[model samples]
Target: MSKTLTFRHVSYLWDEAKALELAGNEVDLFIYRSNLLGADLRLTNYAGGNTSVKIMETDPLTGQPVPVMWVKGSGGDIGTLTKAGCANLYVDRLHALKSRYRGLEFEDEMVELFNHCLFDPKCATPSIDTPLHGLLPYKHIDHLHPDALIAIAASKDGEAIMKEIWGNQMAWIPWQRPGFDLGLKLEQAVQENPNLRGIILGGHGLFTWGETSYESYINTLEVIEQASEYLEQRYGKKSPVFGGARLENTDEQTRKNRAADLMPTLRGLASSYRRMIGHYTDDARVLEYINSNDLDRLAPKGTSCPDHFLRTKIRPLVLDEPEKLAQKSADELKAYLTGKFEAYRADYAAYYERCKHDNSPAMRDPNPVVILWPTVGMFTFAKDKQTARVAAEFYTNAINVMKGAEAVSEYVGLPEQEAFDIEYWLLEEAKLQRMPKPKSLSGKIAYVTGGTGGIGKAICEALLQEGACIVAVDRNLLDETQTDLRKRYGKDNALSAAIDVTDVATINDSLRQATLQFGGVDIIVNCAGLSISKPLAETTQKDWDILQDVLVKGQFLVSQEAVVILRKQGLGGDIVNIASKNGLVAGPNNVAYGTAKAAQLHMSRLLAAELGPEKIRVNTVNPDAVLRGSKIWEGEWAAGRAKAYGISIEELPAHYAKRTLLNEEILAEDIAKAVRVFVDGSLSKSTGNVLNVDGGVAMAFVR
Candidate 1:
């Protein structure tokens, strides 16, 4: 039977003009080509691929021309790679290291030698795959983990399929851990078949090369485009992908709500070893895979691509069916999930025991990084949001690979031992060990109401600096604040939303967005409020109602909604209310605002008492006169306070400072620091407590 083929082609994105512009510098042209390849995720995942170019550089010590290889540095993504992000090494030295190779058992020692070969001592560190490029005789090389090619490389008959697709033009190499040995294998393959254009590493990825950077880039794309076409043709022939749907997909909103409801529990479970931030996706492709009949069969078989499983784990923990999940009460659901989580941990432990070598690093977190719920979607947990999101993306890539492979032939996962060795590999462990210590609030998610306001923004920045993912909730979201936050902290680390804490619907929506954005909220900062300073006689019913609505009711509603998630997560959380010193001190022209502040103070106490059983701590930070950068002081409140104190508005800061024991002016950042003190694990044992950030206001001292 003639093999079916289709014409779904990947575009050749190389720009000859751009290439020509950078042609004078081989390294620049190589980086330019890498960026283009990485720009298309279909070609390779974020930071999953490596590219290289060989150039002759004058040696600084010898003052003689030497061949140097520039490849992507460790942990750098090609799409965003700069010249600084590339590792430059002496090509002759790299080849010389081959003489020291003591075979596969000693391949790992080669990585340490790479540092000695660096042309520049300050150059970015070399990656494990450096030998793969350096050992090759080709001028340019591209090693990518494209889904289409991997689909063929992962199939049971991948070698046969490779022959059918490229005939003798492409070669095949059985799975080998990326190292000097794999480099030698690649070198051997090319030497054996001088006419070959590329080689597919079985159950791993693709490697293509050329004499020039542009040719290498084009050849890589051509191979991927051909694989895509071949897969597309056969994919159509297979009726009902993934054996058709087993469960119907829930509507988008329903899926989101379900995910939100369950995320806290999932996150809590996944955080068994250490706290983990989460990312959820209900993308059409994810939903299709989750709802498929073959999900049970295919998902457990795990991912074939090393890059896919490195982030996603060997396999995912597939949750129960939608009907069963929907029917379970919160308690029942928790129990059911708890059981599943324990089983997954046990299985992971068993795998570790079965595969661990004497020198294997201690088994890391046994929690599942990726979890799939039948009707809802995929949930990925990691040390941070970016990793979680990338894990989901990798799994989605794996799903696509599985789909294509199943169409033409059976999908084959890396053998259990192979997957385990890669996961527990000494080199990977060293990389993990080299990572910087996580910030205090790492893996935490914080929701700050009135987030665009001066104090709120400061609080958000403080929390973000400590590594918390921020959902900046405000009554009116500012584009500038959003842009600044996203730019500085990254889109995944910071989010801005316009929400009214008084409106339950808006509060619900914001929390839902938070849950979907970063799993669930671990910190609730009720900073969204307004103040009305008026003497008792002048304070109208309208003034009282609005103050109560925004200052008291807003805190209550936002806290009330956020607690649902906190409880579901079963993890202790922090709720810091930005109360005022007026709550404790008797002050003139502060009837409405003081009354609302008093309510907020006591409400925090009440919540702390009520939520103590659930380990949720609620604390209050009372600021007496936070003048600079406070929106409250930017309006009528400042004038009212100044008049009440018989001073000019400009004199208020000094006046308030003089009244304090410390005689120090309180700023918005000072108030923000107080909030940080409450939630930043500094006062973990304290609850229902009021901490004054008023430069030592005597009357406001918590009794």
Candidate 2:
């Protein structure tokens, strides 16, 4: 095929040296090619495409050469594909199953039989698109979901456009739910046109094949590049994309502030059925679509590709004009959004009822996965941050598809019945059912003050392991700690902010950052504190003021700002104050520090009572002599306390431990475990209570 139009094209990334390095090994070359294609989002989305290579291997039982097909496994991303991540199957066995194919209605039954054809019984589970690769009569095959190709495939005149672009070099197939029957059709099409190098699945994706992996890789890129160039030429000629912008965007900061303010209420509404973590994006393309006149007309039609809508749901909930929405008070805006949510739920239920078959799974949560707010951005919610973020990305891909289609021809969405079939497909339902149960704090977002310090870092990690997204707040931002948390968990699951919690403005700003990063906060850990040990006669006014400022005032300010977001969510949250054992036990020369801890303890009880009606629980965890990892102990507090005890600084931990009933040294992790128990749904009903994690300090026990 030849192209007349000139535009920027996707770079051909196949390295001759790399290919030559794995010349004799087809599987390795296949993996290399798959990774290269998947490296570009324009070629495929994360885990959205599959690739396969057929190679001859010695049969383990027969000692004879047999053809085996290695394809991307189910739930595996092509970019990250590994040898273990590929499902290996017997090609002859796969082809033999065609005799058992009953028809289109029974094509799903073929998936179960694929297990019988596995070349390795221990191999990864094959994807639903396995037959799309296995049935094709080629050594290498690629099935990708590229926005440019999907644009043509989803256009009203998709077939005609294909004819104009490639004539008979590429074949066009109408929309069909992927299964054994679709694979049979692909085989038939290729057999009839021996010269065909690719096929476009209307309203879906693209398929291309070659005798070698490099040939297939080049063919896939060539097809997408030509389509993109053609679309660009047509796009440039169009006077305005998406019927031109209908609303002017406010300043970027104003949009972000408004988005932050709106997120908690939106998240609460989305979580009405089940809790959902959220992700927000104001990408240029997202803003362009949200501000366009075509948004109302295009957004409700939903997405065309199966991969796009599967993550983004069929249609998004688009809010009213930004100018008008900005005028409403917080309460008024929330009430209005509540009504919108109810209507959306009803509509989704009705759609399920209208299209469900006898074996259809129960209707899922009816909340919109994607929410569009003009002048602000897009908000996507799911059971976790990564899913929510991916949903937003898929919607952005859908927007690109729509823009391209509209530039050349009218954009078309999947037919309602077709969309419903894919959404509620039995196989899809089984996949959903097979997912592992959520962790303790799966969808919760937490704000941990002093998160870079010993106790604070432990709290962050513990919460993260339980699946909560963490916003690590501290007066001193520690890049190493934040990087480690992010790397250990996912980047989205951990964020760090520098703020003086004693300053209300900084406290508000930190909470706002938390809101924007992870929708909103459901748990607050007031672990930020300081200590000043001194006899009353020797203590200075500055020492007293600083202790109170950080230990008492800081907790109050952080809690106060965080409560604003919690109340907006209406999801009843947890507030765990890390008080000191000195608050309950009398200690010589520890007046200022002990007094501040006592104040923090009482504040938790008072807030617990005040916020009880809102379902926000407040509690305290007190730890004594956490000298091993404590920042407080790194200062004069340890030396002062040791001197008061008439012991060397090195002997402080042992001395404190010997005083406890259990005679155990308290660690920061021990304190973290106490905090976890309070918020991990184990003690949901207990609040305004204190837990002593001081290795059994009898005098420090809560009465």
Candidate 3:
């Protein structure tokens, strides 16, 4: 654990910038330097820090050089600092407005006022720490809650520790929830010590400033390095240890396979709480932390720093005595996880009740973001996978911080009252709740068969945009297609599986896996299908068998498994089968394809009736002439269709578009739209019905 702090930047563009005299002074340098500063999870996980540079810009209206500080925008991560991520604000106005609300602490009103003080109204909302940057006299100001600094900053003896570490170099500003009052407090602290290099907010984070971005960044790192050295010298490896650094002693691959085996149950268990859950267990850091013998004691001892309260809860939920879990049945294991989560939640509620009388915000959800199961490793939950990954990163960093602190002294967590003040502070809570309203299917899980292909990706993407996580099920989709999806939705939100859609065992395992990882399935999209377009006389036995297995048997097996999970969850879900137009109407050379789809369409109506009592709705989406991105039309299939129409392959789309009643070309996206409508339960009461997405093809109507 004797690691060095890395200050590597892949590229700084210093040479080109130097030619223009804006090398280190320009706003873009803040973006570049901020990205580097934010990239280190050890320093700032995800969007945990902010960076800025004070520059004078001529106002378009006033035609005068006004003082402006470019601050990290709210919801913008320093790790991905584009120009748009920085908000320019008039520093004078921000400081001047502070005196008007000197006595009043209005959370929402202060945020509103910050928005109005924007130098450019077109810029994003300014950071809540805007005044901290604006009021400081330094030309460059950067703030981050580095765990090492926070370990001492958040300690019971923090002031003494800091006073000893830096003497009079850094000022100590006692615990203030980040807001207008805190900003003014920082202003007062600076006024008292004009020569101070930086200020450590009590139980909060670090603020370092210098004349240039490089100067500020260097100072930030050096201060942190100094603290790390002191902590290490005082109580690192030399100290007597509690169950020193023991691991599961299994190979990495074996650990991951085992974690995967029980992940669905984990997801299902966490989902039973207040929010949808996503996870990251592939991390070696998380694995090392969880596998350690001291996890149960250290993991639940509250966050090493206050900011982690926003991502991880006050502490993690640890399932002790995991050996017993191995003996339990799948249902038993699920129940065990559920029980542990419930107990954690109940305790959280009690904690909130105990603290809210001291002016905390309304009790947020009691769900713990970090779940530590000894056998299965660590899983971090969020509303979606992207945020879950960030939580995972933060929790992983917490592992290092807490252990590092433990090695120094028994890692003293912030008192419950102080943790509460930081957790429910209106400024932080407002940012958390300021997100856009949830969609109808928001935080719901949807499993889409054939998720890698055109229609499947489209369907999953649409659901994702509306706030749903999709487990795209396909054999090949598990590779590149899944990677692309993870890139779009998030590695946590988009999952992929290679499975036989027709095999009951394979189908069941896929559903269970999704269940454990996403709290059981809420919407199932049956989009996996194939068809042979050979003439009846030319078609062989293999073609018929292939069509029947995927189009009919595959639908039955996957749907059957999904229903079992939904029934157990008691959530009343939706199932939308992607049946073809050929199911309703016969076309030439479509004997195998049509008959199999006919069975699928009939099976939907039958399943709908049987599952109606449980409130699980079943419906069919029949799309026609979807020439673009249809997996069914690959290889000889497209040529065969063109031959059937007596036209060149290139002319087929035009020919098919004209075949529709509306004379418009149908696409996979159109089919995905129909599936979404059904999944959203827009036609909630209507099931066992067929909705066509073929640009108004009259022939495909359910006559």
Best lDDT among the predictions, by candidate number:
2
Better of 1 and 2 by lDDT: 2
> Can you tell me which runs of candidate 1 are displaced by over 4 Å?
1-12, 15-17
lDDT of 1 by residue, 1-703 (tens): 1122322565466777887788788889898989988888899999898999999999999999999999999999998988999999999999999888999888888999999899999999999999999988989999999999999999999999999999999999998889999998999999999988898999999999888887787788778888988888887486779999888877888888888888888998998799999999998989889999899899889998888989988889999977887798877888999999999999999999999899899998999999999889999999999999999999999999999899889999988999998898988888889999999899889999999998899999989988999999997656778789989988889988879888999999989989889989999999987878888898999999999999999999999999999988878999999998989998888888988999999999899999998899999988877778888888888888888888899988789889889889988888888888888788899999988888887777767
Candidate 2 residue-wise lDDT, 1-703, digit = tens: 3422332667577789989999999999999999998898888888898999999999999999999999999899998898999999999999999999999878788999999999999999998899988999889999999999999999999999999999999899999999988888899999999899899999999999888888888788888888998998897476589999998888889988988998999999999988899999999999999999999999989999999989988799999977788698877888899999999999999999999999888898999999999989999999999999889889999999999999989899988899999999989888888899999999999899999999999999999999999999997756888899989998879999988987988888888888888899999999998888899999999999998999898888888889989988999999999998988988899888899999999999999999999999999999888988889899688889888989999998889889989999999999999999999999999999999998887788677
lDDT of every predicted structure (CA atoms): 0.89, 0.91, 0.76
TM-score of each: 0.97, 0.98, 0.86
lDDT of 3 by residue, 1-703 (tens): 1223453411222333543564635787777678777767667778887888889999889899998889988878888888788888888888888666745447447777887688899998887777778778888888987877777776667787788988888899887666777788788888898878789886678998878766776777777777777766765375444345564546665555566555545555566644465664656656656766677777667775555767888988876534666799877877777788789889999989888855567777787788776645677777766677678777776765665556655566667887886677777777777877767677688999998888888898888877788888887847787788778776667778877887887787777567556656789999997767889899999999998999898999888878776765556789999988888887888798889988999999999999999888999998877778878778778887788778898998899888778899988888888888887758888888899887777777777
Collision pairs in model 1: none
Against the hidden true structure, what lDDT does model 1 obtain? 0.89
How would you order the candidates by lDDT, starting with the best? 2, 1, 3
Who is ahead in TM-score, 1 or 2? 2
